[model samples]
Target: GAGVSQSPSNKVTEKGKDVELRCDPISGHTALYWYRQRLGQGLEFLIYFQGNSAPDKSGLPSDRFSAERTGESVSTLTIQRTQQEDSAVYLCASSLSPVQPQHFGDGTRLSIL
Candidate 1:
């Protein structure tokens, strides 16, 4: 299949609301990752899922952020109590392995109004 895919290419929500973002990784890819990029900043790692292993959530900046991946296919990132600080582009990437390079999708631009 092609590279990772993210839905709702753009999102705008009110503050204190909750939002969910979806990601579909490349077929047969065993490693998937989520990242966030604020305006004028570099991408920040959010979570990583590899095979059946537990996802790495340490990179999630706050308890309001969480992610889950079923197997190696689709992954979702949920943000609770949206804030202006949460406004950014959410990106998804997939790799054949942890050691391999990742291919990223066009990020979902999120705005908190």
Candidate 2:
């Protein structure tokens, strides 16, 4: 894929179920970011990984939300014990560096029942 690719464009699960969302960023990009956009709200930064540097997870809402990248390639966001309030579109983006423009994926829309 030329751009970021996210799997399972739409997901519907029970409130307590766990979910893992995958993102494959553009090849050669060193910076990757994950964001969550609630209905009618703007994007909320979730996590960021730049090369081998320590990731900045300051935007994570709780311990239930976690993300990791594999050697500047694929990244995955895992949500444990999902809640209804967690419903949103999970966006993934990548860039050459933190200061560069980002290319975003279509996102995975999650709905918790």
Candidate 3:
């Protein structure tokens, strides 16, 4: 893709339901990241995948949230048993390297009812 791509720009789910968000990174980007922006809050890093190494999941809020990246091309974020507190804008970004500026997709706005 020319830039980062995310699926289903908006989502609305009942509390306790599960949701999945997808991301497609740029063609040559080696670093992919997932972040969440709660209403009135700043972006919070959720996970990071770099190349073929182990993914960094330290920032994930809980076991309910998980993400996977295949090589460096595409990624998915799954939030299981969602809660009303989980409503937020989930953003995806990709960069060529750790030191480079990341390019972001519009994001999937998750709304838990």
Highest TM-score against the true fold, candidate: 2
For model 2, residues 5-111, the per-residue Cα lDDT tens digits are 99889999999999999999999999999999999999999999999999999999999999988999999999999999999999999999889999999999999
- Alpha-carbon runs more than 4 Å astray in model 1: none
- Tell me how candidate 1 scores on lDDT: 0.94
Candidate 1 per-residue lDDT, tens place, 9-95, comes to: 999999999999999999999999999999999999999999999888879999999998988799999999999999999999999
Error in Å for residue 35 of model 2: 0.4
Instruction: State the local distance difference test value for candidate 3.
Output: 0.94
- Candidates in descending TM-score order: 2, 1, 3
lDDT of 3 at 70: 82
**Tens digit of per-residue lDDT, candidate 3, span 3-107:** 788999999999999899999998899999999999999999999999998999999999999998888788999999999999999999999998999999999
Clash number for every model?
0, 0, 0
- For each candidate, what TM-score against the reference? 0.97, 0.98, 0.96
In Å, residue 44's CA in model 1 sits off its true spot by 0.6
**Cα error of candidate 1 at position 85, Å:** 0.3
Q: Which one wins by TM-score: 1 or 2?
A: 2
